[model samples]
Target: MNIRHYFDLCVEAGGQVFERIGLTDDYRASRGTGFFTAEHHIRYYAETRVGEEVSVYVRGVDRSDKVVHMVALLVNDTTRRLSCTLEIAAIHVDLRTRSAAPFAADVATAIDRELAADTADWPVPVCGAMGIRR
Candidate 1:
């Protein structure tokens, strides 16, 4: 599979996680705020060809005042092998000012809750310098 596919899959999965953590676009839009990717690290472990379906698993890894780090895993269904891992650090931004901003109280609490849950359930792999950046 193309490397771009893995990136897209990670973003797709991250979007879902954002929604699950009460960070939907609509909510952000109402507040004139949004999340912008500040950094990304993709670790390729295996290759997949066309017609090979994969499943994506994602979770929040960590967060700072203005940034959130999330990790995504893509696994080949048939082979049951890890295909790729994408870690992204996204900044919460104020749309009008176009600058990084802290997340809302409710949103921050929700994300923390989800992060705690994910941390309890999943073994966190080393996310590298990019993840540590935030």
Candidate 2:
């Protein structure tokens, strides 16, 4: 799949997991803010072919005063190959004020717990044709 597709899939899967665990009310709501303004940094180690089953896994999470950090691992189930690794930093801001806020402790805890419990299988070469690493 392409990088854009992969990113969408990851967001979708992550959103689903978050919702199932009561972390989010909806796709947009899960982001804390209306939607995430993400800064994604990704590295591709391999590639995945069509018809292969890929899995997205959350590897870690951290919270600073203004941002929530997530590390995701995408692996190819068929090839047992690691496709890409992503470090996403999403900040929580008041839309009206356009100012950052300290990440909620409850949200941080939930993210941390879910990430720690994550052990999903993944696909290979998680990135698209683009050479972008972040």
Candidate 3:
């Protein structure tokens, strides 16, 4: 319905990556924890309309003790063009504690595997300060 919704859709697709890495529904429910989006950047290259089918693809970019960086693309299925790009920095946190936490060893290993396997190449948006220039 909106630009934000498009980005959210892409993030949801990205979650499939997490699901495969052991962050299953049961695991999240039992552990009472999961990764949360700490920050995101979305750049739109074109507009999409309702009823148009779009595919989202995500790849692991990097990771640290507290966060995983990922890139996702929303593509127009019919036209085969990228609609937008989303860069996300997600953090693992203890839901109860509401604090940053390291990913479980197995989870970390799985993330590393995805990071290594990600061979997707796309143009990254320029990131820095935003401003109105003369």
What is the C-alpha local distance difference test score of each model? 0.83, 0.62, 0.79
Which predicted model would earn the best TM-score? 1
Segments of candidate 1 deviating more than 4 angstroms: 119-122, 132-134
As a whole number from 0 to 100, the lDDT of residue 24 in candidate 2 is 52
> Residue 18 error for model 3, in Å?
1.2
Mind sharing the TM-score for model 2? 0.67
Per-candidate Cα RMSD to the true structure, in Å, reads 1.8, 6.2, 5.1
Worst 10 residues of 3 by lDDT: 125-134
Query: What's the lDDT of the predicted structure labeled candidate 3?
Result: 0.79
- CA shift at 81, candidate 2, in angstroms? 0.6
Off by over 4 Å in 3: 121-134
Candidate 2 local Cα displacement, residue 87, angstroms: 1.5
- Residue-level lDDT of model 2, residues 3-70, one tens digit each, is 88667666776566556545454523545443254576778778877789999876545455566566
Q: What tens digits encode model 1's per-residue C-alpha lDDT throughout 50-72?
A: 79888998877888878898888
Superposed on all Cα atoms, model 2 deviates from the true structure by an RMSD in Å of 6.2
